[model samples]
Target: MINLKEIKNDLPAGIVVFLVAVPLCLGIAMASGAPLFSGIIAGIVGGIVVTLISGSQLGVSGPAAGLAVIVLQAIQGLGSYEVFLSAVVLAGAIQLALGFLKAGSIGYYFPTSVIKGMLSGIGVIIILKQIPHAFGYDSNYEGDVHFVQPSGGTTFSELFNAFNYITPGAILISGLSLAILIFWDQVLTKKHKVFQVIQGPLVVVVLGIVLNVVFANGFPQFALAASQLVELPVASSLNGFVQQFTLPDFSRVFTYDVLFLAGTIAIVASLETLLCLEATDKLDPYKRISPANKELVAQGVGNMVSGMIGGLPLTQVIVRSSANIQSGGRTKLSALIHGLLILCCVLLVPQVLNMIPLSSLAAILIVVGYKLAKPALFLGMYRSGWNQFLPFVVTVIAIVLTDLLTGIGIGMAVAIVNILRNNYKVSHYLYKDEKSITRDKYRMLLAEQISFLNKGNILQTLRKVPENVDLEIDLSKSAYIDPDVRELIEDFKETAVTKNINLTIKEIDRTTAPTDEKALL
Candidate 1:
């Protein structure tokens, strides 16, 4: 069952995903206020351990940006990163329960517009948050959630500070990386056979690292120091490394605060993973539907491993998954390879990785951000109609102004309103207007379920019936009806004589009806 063809097809995609993953893994961990190595550890576990268990052929799991705020807050609130890791481990167990309970289908209930909006919103957030980091401003982390700066400054002002305080080394490396990334597809893509095999991002990363070394000696100008690098936890042995992993302090498990936080993390992470899975599936040329419950289980496993080994919880990240798809990944093999690469790099080449400029990573993220929030994406959403545009725009605005959860809430609200607006329609009818019973009117009748919204139209029509006019209020075909509408009908039936209607109520269970026939006519 191990498909070599699938593995072969995934090589190109694997390489690109590696380029994208390396910087992001570090950035997200940095954002979480956790050790930078924690992210790399999560990535390795997600790619290698989770991939083996996941039902998805193409999904790539790792520490999620959506959880950055949660992780950071949890670390502070819990008073220790180790305590938060305990929560993460517990969260994984909860996710496992959800998987077994078949809760993954809940994702289907969310409208496509809301999901698209979420992706677009996250894209905007990534770009906005990364700007300062790209410019080499280390004053704040890369994933601040609030629209305003931590010290009450605006995004622009904070960005201005970064620009004014710009490190020359950061600017050069980031600028060069971005330039190469921007034109990689246009220039290097057209090169001869061997050069063409290498992707633009890979070349750019390699060049950035090389340039970093060349300028490392006398020109400390180009070299970012160890302070700027990913700090691995102080582990002198494998046992110590394993010991650095955390478990949730079960003493806090029963607390309302801890439960609320756990629920929040579980719900949000599940939704995000589902959305990423959907997007990745869409990108798959083979159009594979990843068994979502299985994905939940795999993510749970990854998070358990991550939490046990001093890492952040995992989700099927859209950026990494998208990169995986774009890179032509055909199987989980690419994920496995990417994970192995992270582990190998960590074990063997931490010194080399520490030299990577934050700017270069920023450049890579900027490119990814542009791809997600491109003007074309906005226009495409607009053309898709208000159903898509309204929620998408709301999500983008709310996220930019607030945070991820707030934006998602706004977008979901818009999506629900749209669904109700589009689905429920009403019209009035009179005793003599049987001719009006066309397809449009019949649609309301045949609707398997009716809500209170249909009551007004039904009441108005019943009131206009001529004296002694025959009427049939049919429920035989209706699968369900709301109590408000039922009560209104009952009241109208009791007084039908005044409206001059001889009405027949069909298919209502006699046992469910009152003994007073007049009360229900």
Candidate 2:
């Protein structure tokens, strides 16, 4: 439900998110080699359409930096933007099918360590990527997550390069903007409700603009060029805005290339959405869990609408969603309002928005990054134990070295190995007990849900049992023993009889595990 009471908070948050999202949408589109306006169309659809159907309160969906490379290649390979849009439409259909099939449970498999690592890695990336922009180097595009830059330098190299091409105006604006945001977030917000009503991001943006105008008059050497400021494309009239919408060419929708691209899109987009949904829910101050399947449905519908109007493929983006949460968005209304604000700004005041400095936006993102990758998070995880801490560290390192999905894959691999190692040693308990049939007898108790992985230990223990002695094998506590283990036990029954051993098998509840009775049957 949309709560009118929180609109005061949501309205201010929406404006802040809109301020951050504009250049991102444009920069992502530019990086993908698509029309810049297409990114805005996606931001609009993702915010308004997705939020209405989505169960996630704080998650904001839009064009993701993760998808930018795929989009860049797919458009060229598919021949044109119109045909790529057709593939995006089909991908949405595939996502809708996945939601109905309950594929959203994939979110559950991401271990807590890996999830924390993913967020921390992304946070580190935000600070690293934006440092260049903050210091007046705009060679790289906004929202670029890759280590190898599309602008021709590595992540660290770009930072080093910033020293040579420093624009004094951008540095001054970003530094002051950072300080103002810190003061607003730390001091002013605690002291009064009025500060909460008057948001820091809004103030930083206004201050940035005023400073740039002052630089132009008083210190021309320190003034920023047009490239260092917000660059929204202005439309001449309503007709021009209407002309921005481009429909997909349905004729090529059935082609093999389009179908293949659609399948790829469906898989990548769904994975990214699930990752962000989990991360966003963790960031929610209320600790509310979003319905993953419902979120998938929302994203599918959003993508379908975006493609119908010629926008880039969309996903649940962590950057904007984190920005929303840190800026104090309480409900889905903040996402809706952010979309409306973007739509209104693009239509009404593109010229005015173009005056906002990118340095100010960079400062805002830098702060969001700090909140995500705090030092305390590392200390807390380290104290949790090595099993949890190792995977978390590996995931963070992997994400910093590679991209989001690649890093997650590495972390999950490490986590799964830890589980397998633990499972290998503790499959069953074999010991002499008072409940044994006689003084010479031994008892073998199976563990619950034993898999083929546990067969080695079971085999070694069974071989050590003396043939002339009585033995009792208990299945009462076990559930769903693997067929291989069952077959081994059956072979042992014959061996026991040959060696004149008295063997007793205890029955388990038939309803809970009928498979255990297959050895006797």
Best by lDDT: 2
lDDT of 1 by residue, 328-406 (tens): 5778888887887777766666666665666666776777777777788899999998878998899888877877667
Q: Go through the candidates in order and give each one's C-alpha lDDT.
A: 0.73, 0.91
Candidate 1 clash pair list: 13-327, 86-247, 86-248
TM-score per model over all chains? 0.83, 0.93
For model 2, the stretches where C-alpha displacement exceeds 4 angstroms are 432-442, 463-471, 492-503, 511-521
Q: How much does each candidate deviate from the true structure in C-alpha RMSD? A: 5.9, 3.4
Residue 245 of model 2, lDDT score: 89
Clashing pairs in 2: none
The whole-model C-alpha lDDT of candidate 2 against the native structure comes to 0.91
